[model samples]
Target: MTDSNQISVDPNTRGNANLIYILYLVAIVVGITSIVGLVMAYLAKGQGDALLENHYNNQINIFWKGLLYSVVSVILIPILGLGILTGLAALVWYIVRCVKGMQALSAGQPVENPGSWLF
Candidate 1:
């Protein structure tokens, strides 16, 4: 009996994706793991099934977008005095994105919008 909702994700792909998500989460404290995860995502891109590929794309986008937000927030620190708030928002945003990615990956589903700027 086959379950139509069951998804068979490749073990290697799932493992790598899971690790990348964890690294992103740990990066909040360690700060270096995010870079490692970014590299992993780049290397793993286009090397998996469609669902895994979507996750890789989402992870890559998260890195670049997070960097942009961080930079913009820093730049606004002295100019507008809102940098701190923006920075905090960026951190929350990053965490949410990672959590969402992990959830989707666990369900064997592609990210809803891999390139979305907001969760």
Candidate 2:
């Protein structure tokens, strides 16, 4: 019988977390999977180790910032044609954040700054 008191850690935690970040990237193309990815990040929030926690935080940050920027872009859509450029920038920023987070997770490292505004 397995020891009930024994604590076992899953070796796939990092990879699983990385998959969420990958989903975020895919969502950029598919445009709907981001909801699933963000939900997974929230669901896994307290279940991961420190590094994974940082990744979750990073993912959450990206989602909120992307949403905020998108809202602002929509508001400015009729102003001087800047909204198109702003929306495109926000999309690129979201992709970069996801890619960087994935790279860090793949390297088994925590994000240096999960709440940073700049990439």
Candidate 3:
């Protein structure tokens, strides 16, 4: 009953995944948008093909891990001012993860390791 010649893809899921990545990137300045992205990722998880599902898991992990890193960085602020360097490093790490997610999504592939903390 299905067309074998046609590929099955949920465009909404793909678009939502892309939007989440963009929201995370925008959070660098806007600060609150990543929360929105996180919620979207959770809502969309397991609702798509394997590729899209992997993206959702990757995004979710990114949010939680990124938050943990940010908090650790902030807590270290008064400790020899180490937070400054740690915060910068956390920012770079967050950016790299988002970029890598976007790249995999664009390639129509699942994330190689959705649970990785490092890029």
Candidate 4:
């Protein structure tokens, strides 16, 4: 019997998934680079590629949240070094998790990232 819960996902697509995750990691390192990749990935969604769309959407959400939060923290520096410290810590953790998530994707598996909290 065919299980309705089964979804069609190619194991070989791990490489593609890895590519997307790498964008998130890079966003941590280069900042702007990740943002550009996120935008490009988002635009690629309308090309009729559902899997890629989902992948890019995940990366985009992560990129924007990290980027925005980091900027906000910097602005709050006047309140003391707490904001900056927390922001940097969170940013570092985000990058590490992004790398781990990429490894998961590269193995044709799923990962739980902060962005995944949305849905």
Candidate 1 least-lDDT 10 residues: 4-13
- How would the candidate models be sorted by lDDT, starting from the highest? 1, 3, 2, 4
Query: lDDT, candidate 3, residue 102?
Result: 97
Encode model 4's per-residue lDDT on 1-119: one tens digit a residue: 88866543332344445565666666555666676666665655555354445555566666766667678788778887778786877677667656756665566455554365332
lDDT of 3 by residue, 1-119 (tens): 98866532343557789989999999999999999999888877777888888999999999999999999999999999999899999999999999999999999988888899788
**TM-scores, one per candidate:** 0.88, 0.86, 0.88, 0.65
lDDT for each residue of candidate 2 in 83-106, tens digit (9 for 90 to 100): 999999988888888888888988
**Model 4 stretches with alpha carbons more than 4 Å out:** 1-16, 27-29, 46-54, 113-119
Clashing residue pairs in candidate 2 (N, C-alpha, C atoms within 3 angstroms): none
What tens-digit string does per-residue lDDT give for candidate 1 at 13-91?
6978888989999999999999999998888887888888999999999999999999999999996689999999999
* Candidate 4: pairs in clash: none
Residue 75 error for model 1, in Å?
A: 0.5
Ranking by TM-score: 3, 1, 2, 4
Could you tell me the lDDT of residue 88 within candidate 4? Answer: 78
Model 2 bad stretches (over 4 Å): 1-12
| All models, RMSD in angstroms | 5.8, 5.3, 5.3, 8.5
